[model samples]
Target: MDAIERDDDDIEFVETAYANVAEFVEQLLLPTYRRNPAKHRWDPRWWEYQEVAMRLEALWRSFEYLRLEGPTGMAVFFRDYLDPTMRELTSENGPFWRLDKLGDERGVPDAWPSESPPRNMF
Candidate 1:
């Protein structure tokens, strides 16, 4: 059997940059990020889509980690994480695609179809 080593530093709790994902998106992300309406799609009611909310939360967590990495932290965060994630999130085929087409009055669109795989496939 193999054993994994645990370090005290790993267990240390670090405070997050923002109180919640919404705070991060409203205060830092949305304010700083500029998107061309013609190319990227964004819905103000982002939380309605589970996938978008999850992705935003992930981005918020990533930002919290990267912000502590010194001067180059923000640049790397933008280049490595924010750019790609935002591109995908706002892409024509992304979670918000239907919202863009159907208009905000229609509400959230149905989730993409999926089927459960055989147990223990992993």
Candidate 2:
């Protein structure tokens, strides 16, 4: 079943993408969460991360929440997944509609903030 295969591929792709997005969100939201594992238990996103990671719809909503929090760099996560229909959906005042249009909260560098990681670790 080619369609089944495609769905499997999508599932795997989304899972990995979700992990990257989640980690980036964590880094942005709280650079020190990793240092304090107990903080994760208090972070709503961290508490629900696993369940949402396994469900596409929930994952997308979580991503939208990230966008609202700070939309910068999110276009990368959905890059390959965007399709004509998906693009149309995002165009209609949707959470993702302005993803490309929204600037970073700081409206500064197109890159991650200095406090953001890959440089600084918790």
Candidate 3:
């Protein structure tokens, strides 16, 4: 069908926009955004962290979708995805929390202690 063909074309366009996650981050993201080191944390080894990797992938997909929408596309992406994601990602307690400002890994903190709720409590 024509709709299916169009969908396939759109997918191809998005997939080819960036060669990989690293390319997106290194080429487009890092250069454009500036972070205050005093308030935020970052590690060059961001891909090593599972949460960071997943978030970056989601951001990349969102970017690919929004970029087709013309002028307001990036505004929406920044408001909806980039701002919140970068805030959480670079927060002190974010996935990079294990690393110090110099990117040295402080000892890992123990996982948060938790227990299952009573049956049917939900």
Best by TM-score, which number? 1
- Candidate 2: residue 108 lDDT (0-100): 15
* Per-residue accuracy of model 2 over 7-119 as CA lDDT, tens digit each: 43462222333345455445443452233222112223333334323433444444444343345535643553323223333243322222233321211113335654675
In candidate 3, what are the lDDT values of residues 35-68, reduced to their tens digit? 8887788887788777888999889878877777
**What lDDT tens digits, residue by residue, belong to model 1 across residues 56-92?**
9989888887877889998999999999999998888
CA error at residue 11 for candidate 3, angstroms: 6.5
TM-score, cand. 3: 0.74
Query: Of the candidates shown, which would achieve the greatest lDDT relative to the real structure?
Result: 1
TM-score of each: 0.80, 0.18, 0.74
Off by over 4 Å in 3: 1-15, 106-122
Ranking by TM-score: 1, 3, 2
